[model samples]
Target: MPLGRGYLALAALATTGGLAACGREQQTYCADQNGVVVPDVRCDDGSPGYYYYTGSYGRGRRPGYRLGGGSRIASTDSNGRARAGLPSTGHVSNGHVTSGGFGSSGHGSSGG
Candidate 1:
């Protein structure tokens, strides 16, 4: 039996690359998207913190985020527009923004 061309190519590439052929574990606190890895901290444990992301839909993508210690905060740009999450607190969405948690400050948008 003989090795296939694809197998030979893969072998050659792997041998040449050595350790580079294997990938490393992504950071626990970060996410990799389209070759650009960024922080994945959606909820800050601190009080009154700002979380920002430069996405395709908008520049300053910050939504109202509620931390664990009953601190509900809204993220805004220099112009003060709704950022990433949603109109309310404790709301997180991957496709669309949605509202969560009853009677919390900033709690009512309804998307994801």
Candidate 2:
């Protein structure tokens, strides 16, 4: 009888340990550097959401600005002129571009 009880206790401890390990695998979501929400398999419930910012995408800009992807958009520049790009053009003043080998038209505008 004592041997049976000992075995039962050991089984119970093992089962509890397994359950604890399984609980550790839960998923969670949090914000990235841009405050963009990144999902992880180890977070708490009822967490607040986050948002991610792209080098091209910014405030008052459209979403889903993918990199290395040929895309375009129609938006106004700092001078309140219309513009477009595949991902985002970031903030361009006086039609000056820094990278991506991109050129600009008058009024901070661009096209393919």
Candidate No. with top TM-score: 2
CA deviation > 4 Å runs, candidate 2? 1-3, 25-112
Evaluated at residue 77, the lDDT of candidate 2 is 23
Assess candidate 2 and give its lDDT.
0.29
* Error in Å for residue 66 of model 2: 26
Q: Model-by-model lDDT, in order?
A: 0.30, 0.29
Q: In candidate 2, what are the lDDT values of residues 21-79, reduced to their tens digit?
A: 54321111122333333342111222233211113222232222222212222222222
Candidate 1 lDDT tens digits, 3-101? 999999999888777654333111111112221223334422222333322222322223332212211222322221142233324333322322222
User: What TM value does model 2 have?
Assistant: 0.22
The true-versus-predicted C-alpha distance at residue 15 of model 2, in Å, is 0.5
Model 1 spans > 4 angstroms off: 1-49, 57-85, 93-112
- Per-candidate clash tally: 7, 7
Which residue pairs show backbone clashes in model 2? Answer: 35-51, 36-51, 36-52, 37-50, 71-86, 72-85, 72-86
Clashes of 2: 7
